[model samples]
Target: MVDYIDQHRERFGVEPICRILRRAGIQIAPSSYYAAKTRPPSPRAVADQQRLEMIRRVHVDNYGVYGVRKMHAELNRRGHRIARCTVHRLMRGDGLRGVS
Candidate 1:
């Protein structure tokens, strides 16, 4: 929604777009759009970026043969203390897969 607003803002303006969205029951305000645009990255997002780099390095270092299970174990064994589910989520999100 924010991206949509950004794309059309120069032509239609933010308030008008927000008004239309509100009329259509989307309930977004111009302030909401501005706030979203100005807000800094969240802690979780920062952590995810750092962890993703680590995951990529580990995956590549091992020839990309590690599946979720092995990847999770390797991260933990290296003192990352990350959950298996997190490893799985990040791997899947980045389209990183392992040999079956």
Candidate 2:
């Protein structure tokens, strides 16, 4: 069901996708997609945003001298509950790097 919705989400808008799915014997409704879209983000997403903000601050506060490993350790020490790879991804997205 999720795969069906994902496959058509781009080609067809949510309404049309739900219509097609309903016609094809799927139980999803347009309202479901609408509700999903309008719903607040999950806790993990909110936490990730906060963690990413911390990573950015740490990077900038150190004049971009913090790389993923150090950033990951620092975030862990600060109770962010994130992975080193996640720190790497966020730092890479923000174009931050170690002083080297």
Candidate 3:
């Protein structure tokens, strides 16, 4: 709704839009929206991006046949020290699937 508020604030107004959103259970303070728009990504987000890139490279290098278990093993074998669940989570988020 931040994008919608930004585009239509001149017509509908910011507080009015936020009020409407709140009624729909999508609560947001204008200050929060503006702050989120200006702030840089958090450290966790940066780490997730880095890990996702590495995961994609592993997936591609292994011919995309390995599932979460093998994917975690391969990443560990390469000295990554990442968790199996994290690999599975990233794979699912990216729409990746094993050949099984």
TM-score of each: 0.85, 0.56, 0.82
Query: lDDT: which is higher, 2 or 3?
Result: 3
lDDT of 2 at 90: 74
What tens-digit string does per-residue lDDT give for candidate 1 at 3-100? 99989999999999999999999999889999999999999999999999999999999999999999999998899988888999999999999998
Quote model 2's TM-score.
0.56
Better of 1 and 3 by lDDT: 1
Residue pairs with backbone atoms closer than 3 Å in model 2 (clashes) = none
lDDT (Cα, tens digit) per residue for candidate 3, span 40-79: 9999889889999998999999899988999899889999
Model 3: clashing residue pairs? none
Question: lDDT values of the candidates?
Answer: 0.95, 0.79, 0.88
Where does the lowest 10-residue lDDT sum fall in candidate 3? 29-38
Deviating ranges (above 4 Å) for candidate 1: none
By TM-score, the best candidate is 1
Give a tens-digit lDDT track for model 2, residues 4-40. Answer: 6777788877778778778889888877766776789
TM-score-better candidate, 1 vs 2: 1
Ranking by TM-score: 1, 3, 2
